[model samples]
Target: MASGLCENCSQLRELTAHLRKVCREFERKIRNVFREFSECNCVRITPERSFLRTTQELPSLRLLNDDETQLLSQESLQALNKLAVSENTGLQMSAAMHYLHLSHLLKSPLPDAFMEPVMALLLSTDLDVQKTISLALVNLLVKNNVCKELVIEMGMLVPILELFQSGDSAAQCHSCACVAMLASSESNKDAIVVDGIIPLLALAKSYDPRVQQNATWALLHLTQSDGSTRILCQAGAIPVLVLLLQSSDSEVQFCSCTALCNIAAIREHHPKLLSIGGHYLLKSLLTLMLSSVQKNSAQACRCLQTLSKNVLIQEQLMELDCVLPLKALLKTSAAVWTEPAVTLLSALSAHPPNNDFLVSEGLLDEVALLLHHHRSSSAIITHSCVIITNLCSSRMGQQAVMESLCLSGLLGALLSPGLSDETLLHVTSCLNHLTTWSEWPGHPLNLSAAITAEQVSGLVKMSGQIQNSLLSCNCAAIISKLEMTEEIIGLLRPHYITMSEYLLVFLKKKDVKFQHLGIVTIFNLKKDGDFSSLLADSELEVELRKVHAQTEETRRLLQMIQPLSPSSVNP
Candidate 1:
């Protein structure tokens, strides 16, 4: 038994040695092929034949048969395992490239063993090899948190940032992408920032569009962290990103818009961005916001949302004629587009001056329609309510909102099920502003839409049903306003001053009421003979003398008393 065990050990060692030899020979042949390809200027190698390319284009992963996929995965991992540990530089580069290419094809995360050698290869001095490795790392780190953790743990940020700082544009692009992917993992964000990735990416954004796009993406990711946004702004990333907003590449435009969005998210950066040609950026984004492309338009709207937070920027945007385009977007049937448009309009409306533009552009009706159409979507409802609430800030906007039939929409929103607390706040606040118009002494809106007696009674009933305090208060106020209207007073005249037994008993005991009744009768003597006759036998002289003695009380009472004029008594 001992002899047999020894023989088995010997065979195992022999098998290991044999496998190593095979890998070495295969590595040699692949290196020769790469050398030959590089040497020939006219040799055009399509990706279909082999992964090698003069342009270093990204590898396309084809679907493999189930059984074949498993076989290839196992064999390729084994080859990579050998090639990764090889001392030869060519072998290491090829292994990294293979890892990059195969990662897209694999169904699972790359094994832990593959990280050490690939990370080590990032230290190579050869520019071509460094570019290849950077590309490999970029592909590996994308949305792959495990790989990102590994990369972070290996302390690869400095090397990666250095590559981006000094390498060619292509290398810098890949390095920026890798760094951005690393920042995608929340745990690694601070580490990447600490390693000075922000300034490097800010500078790299000045390169060609591709590099600028990736750098912008990295800056965008980094800015998501606390304080990193200000760091990016301080590093002067906003102007470069703003400049890229006009790039013909949709990706460049998308990334640049999103980055500036992040910068503008910080209220402190608002002025800085505006001072650095943000108006031009706003113009480009406003134009792109209505683009047919969903991503381009969506990103543009998001950026506008950030820019609109600045009251000054909002004014600037209006000056650029952004209102019309935004109005057009507000009219889109797509909720995806309408949501941000509504959000922006809501922001702009906070400044009273823009309220005029919003009204002049006829935007309230579109917002009102959005509220009714997307009643089921909480986000849409919230945004629409906020817009209406802001639009109510100015008299002109309020008039426009009332004319747009948004008052009913707001009422419906107040009763909507599943309405968020924010939506409820805005809805109640909007109603408060709209109903308060009656409180405005001489405003046309005060008497423009008189509430009927039935509506006033209904609102009183609604006040009882409403559990929200703001809502109940506004409803009660509406009822009070309606009761004060001439039409409502006429309809409710019999009820307002009914001569019930309870009132008669109460008035007899209260001397102040008796005096008030006497003064009121005297004032109505010319307006109605019957009212004067009714009080003639009540000792009007005595009550009038009492009212005259309490001068202050009499003056206040006289102000409260109104004669039974024909307009009120007959209506």
Candidate 2:
């Protein structure tokens, strides 16, 4: 009997030790909970502090248990609702929402039940509270996969839409973003459009630049649907967009311009945009490209590029005298404007539709002059050469090309061993365009003697530095135009290995221009019998494989040649 009693005592001792171990573990867990919760000391509430303490002290507290996360969520929701209505406590509520957001506890926080309170806070007189509540609602919807139906069921869309008209720009911006996020869902887009998104966009135009910017982004997102572009046009978005382009804020200008780009991207909407003040806006945008501020000018240039490529827009632009500003921009000291200037000039000069406009505007002589005088910097010279090449591609352009007496200057630039790869590329491309245009069936001039044996000699002297992909492509283009098979073959013989290496490297670049130029060069080179012998060289075969693969892709998507549009007159 004594032994049995001793066994029971031993079992009791073991039970006591086990209980102590469990208690210690529970205490450590509580401490950890407190540590994490306190990390966000940004939240300050007497009741919240007490609740946190209670949960920490009783590690096994029902409220602290994951199983009870839903219940705690209910309690937190009630607290938020009450605090949201209390003016003095709104900041605390915001802090709590932030903490909940950061902790990713929204899914467990009974989002559906809190929707009404959030909608109410969104209409609060306090801007800060309104912004916070709107952000929290967005977080709730995004985090919990809450449907737009849930929002509509709670009768929240109206109030949210009302927030777009709010005087507080921050609140309005957030509301627009939230609406945009909701509208992205196919289910939500139709309702958003039907519920007067168009009128709201018009209203947003008058708001501060930040609000306008956000609203434009939201409108762009909404207009991504079919038939929405027409809706936007009918709702007078174009006029507002044009006005917004004149905004001093670069961001507002960019967003507005980008919206125009999207509008133009839709083929059916192109005519509508032109009818609805697109032409005048293009002129204004071109003027902006001449802004002393670099940012403003760059934004304007991008906008013009977008509009210039559209068939309807190009025709419209060509009717006006856009060549003057374009030429002026090319000669402008702003290096940033140089590329767009060249691009515009090239586009205008290359398109048959704009050839007459360019000639009538005396653009060819101006372009030729720039080409002749701007060789101080290789980039400037190269860009000028591209412009001239574009000019020379047309009958009128060739007439001007021949009349300008600048071909000799260009050929000299290409032969100069000191020219940068970029300069050489540009000069050779210009020469190629001039030669090709001159050789056409009804051509006005001949460049056959212009690129004669002396020219080949000059080109060969720089063959070492000209081994780069860019310059090699330029050389090939020039040779193709001149049809200098033997001369090109001789140049490639000594540098087959280097040529192949550079060609392969050039094909891998992300730049489309580089790829296009490289492929064209290869195609021209292969036309010459020397290319076959060059390909026979063992070292070039692998590089040739890569080049062939890239060239095939490029050939499928041939270079697009767009004409200049009629110039828009600035009011």
Candidate 3:
């Protein structure tokens, strides 16, 4: 019985030993599979298995998860540091660095310790890697926002600026985008300019179109601030941009045009752009506004809009025969061109010199044609009518506008129930301008009287009908101009409460003319004691005092307009 019991104990011990060996083997197999998956996933693994083979069939092994990701990053970075010292390994190191970055993107925020090593990659000899790393850093920095202080502290401006001069288009584009993103902060703008972004723009002129486009875009962003505009102009970016306007690539031309617009946003930069043959280029740009491509036309129009803001540039554009092309574009068959075309014409007609040009070019006839005949979008019709309004606001242009029978169509537009708020405002304002035209050298006062009465009736109807603030302003201005005090007083006699509220609202507006109109309308209505009570109750007296003060201030400024300097004058 003792021998049998001993035999059972021995068998039990052997079974226990066999089970332990099988457990160890199973653990080893699981680890091997994990390592294989990590390597395949391009993640980091433990040092022991990083360079170890998982099987005879597959020579390379990987990590299980984020552990392997970190391992690969450390190894690649170390390799990059070593490879930076040698010429041949530069390419390999670049590839390896990119691989690590790809891995980093797949993971969460990297440990703060990795910032230094990753930034050093920007200084790599391989332009490809330098650009890749620069772009990657920009993405990381913009996304995190926490990297700004750290990146600025690292003194990265010089190396990154040097990349702007790279011959590789992709490299240059990426570098430009990165720098632009970094310089978006106002405080950073100074450092970026000081780092030679302006000079680099000069060197980058010969790059491919994509690079040029990005460089110009970056230059635009960089020059948005007051200080940077001066720096960029001093660095010769204006001339470069003007030349780039002649580029065959529409995209480059568009970017160049946009850059010019930003630069021209600064009033000081305007004359400088004009002095550098910007007018000649502007003529070329106007020619391109006829392009069938919407983007090109839109960009050209935008540039023209910016240029027109400068009195000098506008005069130059007028001297270069810009009005003819602008008029032609306005009258084009394509309705898409109408809005921008009308805007350009409005801006051009706002100035005295260009107004004279428009009159001479028979632009009023063209505008009348659009108002009388063209069936277009309400927005386009509104813009066309507004252009006429702007043109007729000038003394000489108003004669041309009225003689062209613009009043008939304008009155129709104002009285038409289907007219949009925008068109109503435009037609009313045009009437306001023409109502002041008692007589002209070529036309008699009778013609003006007939037109003025028709316009006043239409505007009064509109004032009672439309609800838009701008339309109301236009109606009030026309009423003020026509001396229709009795008519307005009679209209408000029965509904003094509603009239008082509307007049009070109009008086509070910042527009000097509209405010004056409100005051005049109120003073004329005061004949009725009931109207006076309403006006006094609505505080119209205090508002009238404010409007009178503003009018005096405005008149003082207007009286101070000296003859422009020769350089200031557009001709």
Of the candidates numbered 1 and 2, which has the greater TM-score value?
A: 1
Q: List model 1 lDDT by residue over 1-571, tens digit each.
A: 4445577798998899999999999978976885687556554453312333421222221222233254245445455555455555565576666655555545566677656656666776666666877786776566362468778888777778887667478777778788778877778877776666555555445557777767777777877876766666776777777777777778877777877777777777777777855467778788888777777787788888877766777777888887777777767777787777777777787787777777888888887787777776677777677777777778777778657768667656655667665565566566666766645444444422544455444444444443454444455444434433345445434432232222232234344543343344245332434434554545444445554667777688898987679988899
How high is the CA lDDT of each candidate model?
A: 0.64, 0.62, 0.65
Clashing pairs in 3: 38-63, 39-62, 43-68, 44-68, 44-69, 45-68
- Model 3 lDDT-worst window of ten: 54-63
lDDT of 3 at 131: 64
Candidate 3 C-alpha lDDT tens digits along 525-569: 666677677666357778777777877897899989986789868
Query: Count of backbone clashes for each model?
Result: 0, 8, 6
> What's the CA RMSD of model 2 in angstroms?
17.4
In order, what is each prediction's RMSD in angstroms? Answer: 15.1, 17.4, 14.8
lDDT of 2 by residue, 391-484 (tens): 5555666676677667767865655546666667677767656665565455445554555555665554433343475555556455445444
Full-model lDDT, candidate 2: 0.62
Better of 1 and 2 by lDDT: 1
